[model samples]
Target: MPYDGFKDVKQIVKGDLEQYIIYQNEEVELKKFDNFVNLNDVLNEMEIHLKAYNRVASIQFYGITQDPETHSYMMVLEYEQMRIFEKI
Candidate 1:
């Protein structure tokens, strides 16, 4: 199912494309996609059973272009510019 819950598609499209680290803020080389994959479909597939630790301000999608062509796409989620206090 598509990530229909997100009312705005622009949230993912507007952000700039850059290398983003996965959990624990570690940087790793990832593959990129070509031929224009659907943004919503990619997001929805990724969100399955994913947990959010901090407040999310926006989500960004990026394409890791390559010469040999390995993977299809890469998605990045950006958090809001605010402090998120843990509910201790």
Candidate 2:
């Protein structure tokens, strides 16, 4: 991937549903499309679980990853400029 044009990514897209890396900095190298999650079936329900203040999240990670220090299979959700962490 080209680092020069690396924008602050919000979501990874697979057809209709989308996701993005939870956090990206010059030090972190996230592999795009390493894992693709199909949220088409569960997004609505997921939003219900993670929603806050009536704002629905419309972004996710392109791949499933563990927080290096946590080492757990976690889901990173982004919406309304906030990031939500959930264990799946």
Task: Report the C-alpha lDDT of model 1 over 1-88, residue by residue, as the tens digit.
Answer: 1222222222222222223234334223222234546756655544541234223432232222222343345443433321231121
Worst 10 residues of 1 by lDDT: 79-88
Report per-prediction Cα RMSD to one decimal: 13.1, 11.2
Which has the greatest lDDT? 2
Cα misplacement distance, residue 57 of candidate 1 (Å): 21
User: Which stretches in model 1 have alpha-carbon errors above 4 Å?
Assistant: 1-26, 29-36, 52-71, 76-88
Candidate 2 lDDT over 1-88, as tens digits, reads 2233334644443422244432454322232222324544244444444454134444433333443332323334333333222211
Worst 10 residues of 2 by lDDT: 27-36
- Please give the lDDT score at residue 63 for candidate 1: 28
